[model samples]
Structures are given as structure tokens and as C-alpha cells.
Target chain A: MTRAAPNPARRIREDIEGRIHSGEWKPGTRIPIEQELAARYGCARATVSKALAELVAAGLVERRRKAGSFVAHPPVHSAVMTVPDLAELIAARGESYRWEARAILRRKNAGGADTLQIDGIHFAADEPFALENRTIELAEVPAAAEANFAAEAPGTWLLAHIPWTSARHVVRAVAATRAEAAALATGSGAACLQLERDTWRGDRPVTHVRQLFRGDRFDLVAEFQAGTGKREGN
Target chain B: MTRAAPNPARRIREDIEGRIHSGEWKPGTRIPIEQELAARYGCARATVSKALAELVAAGLVERRRKAGSFVAHPPVHSAVMTVPDLAELIAARGESYRWEARAILRRKNAGGADTLQIDGIHFAADEPFALENRTIELAEVPAAAEANFAAEAPGTWLLAHIPWTSARHVVRAVAATRAEAAALATGSGAACLQLERDTWRGDRPVTHVRQLFRGDRFDLVAEFQAGTGKREGN
Candidate 1:
């Protein structure tokens, strides 16, 4: 009937995970030995070992036989597909993030529901990071019809407001068009990464977005374990 | 010990899955209704429904409220990262695949182990599809040293001959340099999709490869479900 006591092994794992996630323990930084961690946490060495093993399984730590464990490199990969918030991604890189809306349009769909389309640019450290075009189905998200997207990125706003059920991402590289080049501050014909995403809430479509990023600045990375079907989301 | 009889529902699910995977049932093809499927399979309607439900959960089928289930679109997405065999991929597209080794170099590492480096071009239907540069650590994959890469791609060869423990992929867009442009039969500065991958056997590195695909021809796709972290391997 009462709450169960917290597991020490889980607590230790979370503590180490927190440090790694917060960037306090950079990649390659040595984690304390099992004996040292046991002494510090006032737990058995097996408990510390269990926590470290979990971290290793999660790809957050690497254990060397004679040497101690070390924080694994921060993965550049996203979950195969994820709806990441660009503002958060930029901020995490220790850069100032900004979003500027270039155009906004509201129109009626064939079903007589409103659709909101937005054109915008995202900046990191005052440099153009990506150009985005997004459409929101107002019938499914009526609140978006009145949202002030010019003052904030709609993607960020939508994440905080809507509950998405499924998403699809198509990633490709293309020559930057003149208009896209002008907006992204890259040379026309330069290679660029283009990502198109469609999100749905159950059977209804919620939003569709296309974002273009400068070839020099952005990339997608993914890591895999042999014979494992499971992947962690970003 | 005796093998248990296969569940009817599982049999139905596997049958449909095989058809979908084999491309016999293209995307958007409507599946027979439960009653029809039940009659065909000589099973109860509930069993058919159960099989359909499993297919839906696997993202291989889509069920509409008023309409029948349909074969979902072929997902372009790969498991976040996979060590795919290029020959198989090209052949799947019904293209004549060719592997041309432009150059091969063998060197000694600091540890005095042999390292083989290969530069090659992959052709699909007589058109260059990708430019590949690969390095294999012979200490981990000794068979690679004697492999006849001129007749076969090392990527495909490695996939067949070796067992890898893990892999990392970095995807980016890049402007093709003059040499790359010539090799890929594209104009200089044209957009290209570059994928750099490193595969390992346990803790020892096996191979490192970089492939450049024409921006217009190649892309990566991924699909995700809300609140779920599991991703299928390609």
C-alpha cells in the first residue's frame, strides 16, 4: 500500500546518467572505479557494477578491462527519426538561438478546415542554421490558428502544446536553390541537408514540415549494436 | 521435446508480412476484409483480426475505420543505423549493379598489422550511384587481405564474411570537389550526400568507410511512434 524504497543501483545509474546528459562528464572522462563508486555511494561494489553495466548497455559508458570505465562519446545520431526542437538543439551547443518568421498564411482546406503555413529561419550564434516551412492543420489544432508564431518557432510551440502519435522523416541532400541559398546564407548550388517530416495524432495529420540546413554546419549521426533491434530515441 | 504447432494467427501474420516484405503487396494495396481473410485462411474472424492487429503494431499494415486494412507504404526509413549491403540494395531496385575498384592500397599500422584501403565506384544500371572509400583493419579481418575486391565490393564482401559488433554512421551533405565530381560524373560543387561509417568487432575496429551519393538520387527515411523508443533494424 505504500511506496517502495528506491533501488540503490538505479539511483547510482541515474546519478551518472544525469552527469553525462548534463555534459558535466564529457566524453572520455573516466568514471570512478567500482570500488570507488561503492565507497562513495555507500553501496556494495556489485551495485556499482550493475549501474555501470546498465550505462554500458545504454551506450553511455565504455568499460576497459584493466582501465576504469569512461563516458562514451556523445552520439551525434538521432533516434532513426525524431521530432527535435531546433531551439533546444542550438542552445545545447552553447549558442544563442533565434527564430525569425518570414511569412505566414492562413487558408481553408478542401474539408473547410483552416490550415496555417509558416516560413521561417532559425539561427544559432547569429548564423543561419536552417530554413523551415511548416503547415499546421488548424482543424486538429485550433489553438494554432491564433498562436503568435512570429514571436516563437511553431515547431517548439507545437511540441509543448500537442501530443503527437506518429512521425515520419525523409532526409536527403540537394543543391541549394537561389532563394534557399539567400535565406540560409550559403552559396547557391551548395550541398544542403533537407529533412521533411509529417506528424500525426492518431488517424489525423497534425503538421508537415520541411527544413533545410547548411551542408557545412549540420549532419545526422546514428549508432547501432550488432544483432539488436532496439534503438533509443533522441 | 516436441515442437508446438504454430498458432493460426501467427501463421496469417507471417504470410502477410512475407508478402509485404517481398513487395508482392505494394503500398496502399487494400487487404481483404476480416470475413474474407477468415474464409480464405479457414480461420475464425477473430483470428484474422488478431493477425491484422499484430501487423498494425509492426507498422506493416494500416487499418481504417470504415475501410479495410491496407499494406502500408514501404518505409524509406532505415533502422537508425545499419550496415547495408550495397549490392543487395541496388539489386532490390531492379538495377544492374556493378562494383569497380578504382584503387587498392595495403599498409602497415603502428601495431604492424595490415590495413587495406579501397577506393571504388558503385554503379546502378550503368550510372555511378556512389563513390566509396573504405579501410579494413586486417588484424580484425584477416580474410580481407586476400579478398579479391576488384571483382566484388568490400562492403558487400565484409557483410558476407565478417560479423560486426557495432557500427556508427554520420550523414551529411557536402559540395563535391573537382575529383569527386569527376568520379561521380557530376559538376563541381554539386550537392552530395556523404555517409561515413565505422564498424567494429567487439572493441576492435573492423572497417571504416565513407560513401558519397548523388544528392538527387539517394536519401534516408525514418519513422517513429510517440512514447516509444524501440526502432527496427533495416
Candidate 2:
């Protein structure tokens, strides 16, 4: 079946989105009414309505019952989890950033099954050092991953090379294993925080990483606006 | 300023969304092309494009470059976080749900600056028990909160009484404070999983809760899809 070469509604949608994205139409600014837009585009009123509806669903525009529509006041549904950078995180808190890689083993990471485990050591004088254990799958490792892993930590290396499009994170509490306690200079079965991250590029998953942090030394803080109905797994 | 009455494009968008939401249009199923949809809806082709674009933004439909649109294969972007119910969580795991309220204090929850703390006692046989400290603003505390706190845990109470439309959660790892160790029956320096949740009812903030979990016994898991350009902060 033949399709319209240049879908007028799509073109109009792109035009408005371009303005919004490029900052031409600032947040909360009102765009022209459908009638005015229809006249400008020389299209039917329905066409303008269709284009605006696209912007509305995208959270780019807000439509009130009787107030027409305005560029949405920038949604508040975003979740911020900074890229995993251990040195930067510690330095941000004005603490000395010290890292020691205990081991790096190559393994398969097919179907989200992880294969490599990297240990990050922290220097805690007279205190239990945190244990950060990360496991990554083999398939997701980049071509230069081995060299990068040897030169620096895998998390740091992956951050520099891989450009992931999406990521999911699960945070949980768990007791430190006996080995973990010894490694972190704590008692067996101490409390700890575990963070699991899965990153993907389009439909292809790039890597899944599991990190265990010594509970006493770290905290993750995030704030978000509510009720946009955008789910949390981005 | 005049608007078109009875937005035909909106009607078309809703009709399509309803079918998708109701499972009438199964995932991976391709509905009629835009030409056919426009004809069937008795609207301009642009009107149908607008409706389909909404579905695409919502992750409900996929539009190919030239192949037209189809119901999206079920999205993986949905973040699954069940309501915070201690009893229900335990029961769902095939274990008996048991909870004991240790303390409930009246306090202020100003601008998410929590002032109330709720302690949930664990019935652990020998493990280090966790303490949940919740601070809420006075403004968010409902009129009947005191009564509810005396009768049951505030978290459970708020879940039942307040109809929160949105929630934000921040997870972190932290060392237990001296008072916390004594209250939770663990060492003062022990590790813990801290969860801070702020709930809201529209523009009105409702409650902010912070819970410390015994690291050994709890884990939160969430999964999501990739490449919807919604930022982390909406």
C-alpha cells in the first residue's frame, strides 16, 4: 500500500518539537492555537490537532480542559542515577578516592547472565572498609574491554567506552558474606547495600552489573516529581 | 482563542488507546494502515496520524520508517514496585507476615524534611534486627494520624487513608547511628539499607518516610525497558 510521502501531521509535529527542543518555545510558553496553526501550515484543523496530540503524549505539551495547551512545564518524572564512577563519587564528598582492583575474570554474559566479578577496595582506617563486588557478562564486554579492565576498573572503563541508551537499577540490602566481611575488614554477615544495573543500547542489552557497597560508607539520594505516570525503569 | 468543539482526533486517539489497553489490540498486531484508519474514523489522514503518534509516545505502538505502525510488543519499561506493605511482602514470599510497632512519634514533615520516626521491630531469631525510622512533616500528617498510629503502623495507616497519586524513592547505604543500634538491637556501626520515600496527592505533598532494613533480609528488584527519551527528572 502506498503511504503519504510527507505525512503533514508528522511534519507539523516535528516542527513544533524542534522549536521546543531547541528552546525556541520555552517551557510554559503557549504556542499558537490550532486554528492559527492550521492556517499557518495550510492544513485542516484536524491536522493541527493531531500534531498537538503527539506533543501532549510526549509530555512536551500540556492541555487543560478549557485553557487550550501550553508547552508542558518540563515534567518532574525523571530519575537521576549518575553514571557509576567510584573515584568521582568519593571525590565529590571531599574524601580521598582510593581504589584497588582485586580480581578481573573473563566470562560469558549471555541472556543477562553475568560472568565477571571485579572487587573495588577502599581504605578505612580502624573502620570496616566497604566491599564493592561487580559482576559483568562476557558478551557485553567491548573489544577493548580487557585492556581497559587491566588499566583501570571495569566500571570506569565501561563508562568511557560504552554508550548505553537505557538502564535499570535495583537497590537492595543484604548481609555481607564471610568472604565479603574479610575483604571489607568487617565481621562475617555485616549489613551491605547491593545495586544491580542493566544497561542496553536500543533492543540490545550491553551489560548487567551488580555492585555491593559497604553500608556505613555510602548513600544514594534521588528526588523526583510525582504523577506523570512515567514508569521508573528507564 | 476559539477552539474546535468535539475534537475528532482526540476521540480517535482514545478509541485506539482503549482497544490497546483492553487487550482488544494485542501486542505485535498491526491494525489497519493510516489510510484505512482515517477512512474508518471519518477524519483526515492527519487526524489518524496524530492519534497513532500518541500511542507511539506512550510505548503502546511502534511506527516503522515506512512500514506503518503496529501495537508495540509488550514494553519492558514498566517499573514494578509494589505498594510498601511489610505483611503483604512476607506473605507473598510464602512466609508468614509479622510486624510489631515499636515507636510512633508525632513530628513535622516540612518540605520533605522529616521529623517523625516509626520503628518496626523484627522478630528475628538471632540475627541483627533492623530499625525503621520514619520522619514526617506535621503538615502532611492527617487529622486522624495520631489515632491511626496508636492503632497500627503509620506506613500502613497512610497507605490505607491517604490516596497518594505519586511517590519518589531514594535508596542508600549508611552506617547505623548509636541510638539506632540500640533501638534496632544491632551494633552502632553496623550497615543498613536506608529507603526514603515521599508520596504526594497531586500538587500537595502527603508524606515522607524513611525505612532502615536489615541488610541481610531485604532486597528490592526493579526491571525496565530502554530508549524512551524521558529524562530522569521528568
Candidate 3:
């Protein structure tokens, strides 16, 4: 069989995506319609349709029955928790990383929906930039409490001292709470990214953490692998 | 190197968790305060403290200063993806799985703020029962359309038919829209789980999809190998 060059639809999708990504075509801005695009690109309408379909699936554009194809904006929040320290997470992206702790002490979260048995030193940091609340089992994972955050986040501190076996994460996009807004230095009603996680090692539940991230500043990603006989053994 | 059984904090966290998981303490139901629980459990306030802290992290409870801790009643959602097929996911825990396509059609999507290309087949099953909207790259993945949906979802179908080199995912929570509420078989204002993804074989983006799941019914989970060198390979 004669192998062909890349398909036309992919080329178009990429060409258009590149423009959008390059900000030549901004969100909410309509590009050429299918008919116009078909004429200009010298492809059949079906080809343009195919290319558009892939972009839609990838969540790059919005379409209506006859509204015409246009560019889609980036997700307000693209959150990925790949298990890196705060400094590393920010720094890995080539963005400058900075952090500070306001206060440090052993404290109790006495009220909420449940009584948390937190025993780690508590501290506050620059707004949503890197505000985090963390806990480590002093007994089951006694190494947690021994983490010396120093100028680092307790979250980073714990990661260095203890080795967690497993973790459960509960994440969401919620309007900021009054107190949370104040603590994170964002005004109330502003959109914020909330992450609530519970981690375990083997059969023992280890630590739980709740973190709030500025929506514009973060992205979360979870890569998928073929779960066939060759399941990537995480 | 002496490994012993878990300490008192683990025991207490487990005890309380068992109660919650066992329905001893239902959602929104008030539980004893720290002082009360500390005395009742016959452990030090510190031990009770540790236990509850773990629960908060696990998202089983909520804590408010001075107000006391109560079970965090809002239904906790888990990120459940990467398994390739929903049947395998449901059956992993030993449950009978059934899937039927309620709607499937080729449509055009105008670019939204999230992305720019929108042209593909949209598939939705029985609401939280199931929903998948993906782009079939006609230009690149010719077999996308005209594939089988009789026995599996589009995700499972394509995985079985083609071999793409790479994929990317964006998972987040979306509040139900009037249309989503009707389509998902849920009430308006309910939380809906949304995942936006882009996949590439290498440099070429091959596929894109956005899936909305019934929030009351699903959770997302991923296992990580600690110290896998550094997290976030990208």
C-alpha cells in the first residue's frame, strides 16, 4: 500500500490550532466558515468537517448547527497534580518560584464537617500562589511531623521526610469562601481551584491535605495509558 | 529497622472512619467535639486530634474553628478515568455493567473559551449512567467514524481499533447546565464531572474529547510511584 503524507484534516486542525495558540485568532472570534475554509484550503467540506470534529473532541472550539467554526479558549483551570514540590511545580515550567510561611505551630482544626487530627506545624503563605493546609500522621507516619519546612511549605517538607504509599484526591472548582478568599488574598466570589486529598501507605491512611490554587495560575493533568495486558504499573 | 503496628492516632482515625463508612455517623450529623471525642475514645486529645485530622484530609469530615468538626456532607467526588473502558471500571469492583447509546450524531461546535476546533461525533448514554463526546479525526484517524458502538464506548472502540502514540487529559468539575441536566438525567444545579482531553501520537495532536459524568455517581483516582525520579514528566 502506498503510504500517504499526513491527513488533510489534521493539518487543518493544527494550522488553525497554531493560529489560536499563537493568539492570532482569539477565543470567541470566528474563523472562515466550512464553505470558505473548504475553498481556501482546497479540500472537500467533509475534510473540513473531519478536521473540525477532532478539534471539538480535543476541546479547542465551539460549534453550533450553523454558527460556523471558531477557536476555543484554554480551560480556565488546567490542574495537574503530578506529585512535585511547590517550588518544583512552579520552577519546572520555567516560571520563577517563591514562597514564605506566616506562622508555624501545632494546631487543631476543631470545626468544619469533621474533626481533623492534624499535628503538623501550620503556616500561611503568599495568596493563592502557594497557600496549602497539610497534615501527616504523627504515629502511623511519624516521619511526617519531623519534617522541617524551614523556608519550605509543609507540603514540600512532608514529601521530603515521609514516603506515602498511596493517596486519594477529591478536587473541585468552587467559588471562594469569605474566609478562604481573604486568606488566599483573592476577593470573595472569585473562582478558585480547590483540592482536597487523602493519602495512604499500604493499608494505613497517612495524611490529608486541602489546597486552594488561583485558577489562572495552575493546571492539572492526568495522563492515560492503555490498560490492556500492558497496564503501566504506576 | 523495626516495623510495628500503627500507633494510637491511626487506630482512632480508623475507628472514626469506620463509623462514618459504616453509617454510624451520617452526613451532616453532628459528632462529639474534640474534648468529647478525646474522652470517649479513651485516648489523649492528641490522639483524637490526629485521627480527625486524617479524616479531614480523606474528605470524610469538615473542620471549622471553634464551631467544631462535623462530617463533610457534600458528596465527595473522585476522578475515575484512564481505565479505557467503563465496563472494566465498574467490573473492577465486581459489578455488572451495561451500556447503550441514547444519542450519537455528527455535529459542529463553535470554539468555546476552552478550545478552538469543534467538529466530531457526539455520544451520550444514560446520563450519569454514561456520557462521552469525542472528535473522530477524519483527517488523521480515518477509522474514527464508522467504528463500532454496539458493544463499547467510543473510547474503548478506538482503543481497540487504532494505535495512537500519545494522549493528554484535563479533568474538572462543571456545574450542570440546563442542557446537561436534561441530558445527564440529573437535576439542574447539580455538579457534573467534566474531562477535556487532547491526544497526540508524538507531535501531531491525534484526538480530542470532552466527557461529562454524573457527579453524584463518579470519582477520579490515579496511583503514583513515589520518587519516580521527578513527577510531571512534561
Once fitted onto the true fold, the runs of candidate 1 whose alpha carbons sit more than 4 angstroms away are A1-83, A227-234, B1-83, B227-234
Q: Find the 10 residues in a row with the least total lDDT in model 2 chain B.
A: B225-234
Instruction: Return the TM-score for chain B, candidate 3.
Output: 0.49
Ranking by TM-score: 1, 2, 3
Ordered from best to worst lDDT, the candidate numbers read 1, 2, 3
Candidate 3 lDDT score at position B62: 77
Which is the winner by DockQ between candidate 1 and candidate 2?
A: 1
The lowest-lDDT stretch of 10 consecutive residues in candidate 3 chain A is A225-234
Tens-digit lDDT track of model 2 for B46-145: 7788777766765668899778788776443333333345433444556543356667665544455445666665434434344555555556554544
- Winner of 1 and 2 under lDDT: 1
Worst 10-residue lDDT window for candidate 1 chain A reads A74-83
Tens-place lDDT digits, model 3, residues A1-234: 322335777778878876665546766779789988877777788779867876765556778878777666433212233444555566555665444444445544333222223322222232246456666555555554544555565555555444233455665665556876676676664445556677665465667777666555555666543211111111
Model 1 lDDT tens row, A1-234: 222336888888878876765546767889988999888888888779877876775667889998989987533233343235777667767998777887888898899898999988999988899999999999889899888876778877876666334676777899999999988887888799998888877568989999999999997777665323244333
Predicted structure with the largest TM-score when compared to the true one: 1
Model 3 misplacement above 4 A: A1-81, A91-131, A140-150, A163-196, A199-206, A214-217, A223-234, B1-83, B87-130, B148-151, B185-191, B202-204, B225-234
True contacts kept of each: 0.58, 0.37, 0.16
| Whole-model Cα lDDT of every candidate shown, in order | 0.76, 0.60, 0.55
In candidate 3, position A56 carries an lDDT of 69
**What pairs collide in candidate 1?**
A77-A221, B77-B221
What is candidate 2's TM-score for chain B alone?
Answer: 0.55
Best by lDDT: 1
